[model samples]
Target: IDEFWDYDEADRLKAIEISHAYRKSRGRSRR
Candidate 1:
């Protein structure tokens, strides 16, 4: 159960990173 939680946390972080990068790219394109 602990391992699963850790994995989920890592996945959430990764998703956030991806979304952040995506937004940056979109902003650059808009400018």
Candidate 2:
């Protein structure tokens, strides 16, 4: 259970980072 939760947390963080980078790139394109 602990290992599963750890993976979930890591994946969530990774997804958030990807989304942030994507948003930054998109914002530049709109400018």
Candidate 3:
């Protein structure tokens, strides 16, 4: 159970990081 929880947290962080990167790229393109 602990392992599963950790995996979920990692997945969420990865998703957030990807979204942040995507937004940054989009902002740069817009400018």
Candidate 4:
């Protein structure tokens, strides 16, 4: 139970980090 929740949370955080990186790269490309 706890391990499952932790895994889910880590996945969510990883998604957010990926999106942030994607946006940053997009902005750089727009330059």
Q: After aligning candidate 4 to the native by TM-score, how far in Å is the CA of 22 from where it should be?
A: 0.3
Best-fitting candidate, scored by TM-score: 3
Judge candidate 3 at residue 19 and give its lDDT.
100
Tens digits of lDDT, candidate 4, 1-31 = 9999999999999999999999999999998
lDDT of 1 by residue, 1-31 (tens): 9999999999999999999999999999999
Instruction: Go through the candidates in order and give the clash count of each.
Output: 0, 0, 0, 0
* Stretches of model 1 off by over 4 angstroms after superposition: none
Instruction: Write one digit per residue (lDDT tens) for candidate 2, span 1-31.
Output: 9999999999999999999999999999998
Question: How many clashes (backbone atoms < 3 Å, residues ≥3 apart in a chain or on different chains) does model 3 have?
Answer: 0
Candidate 2 minimal-lDDT segment of 10 residues:
22-31
TM-scores, each model vs. reference: 0.89, 0.88, 0.91, 0.88
- The C-alpha lDDT values of all candidates are 1.00, 0.99, 1.00, 0.99
Query: Candidate 4, after superposition: displacement of residue 3 in Å?
Result: 0.8
lDDT of 1: 1.00
Alpha carbon lDDT at 29, candidate 1: 100
Question: In candidate 3, how many Å is residue 24 off?
Answer: 0.3
CA RMSD of all predictions: 0.5, 0.5, 0.4, 0.6
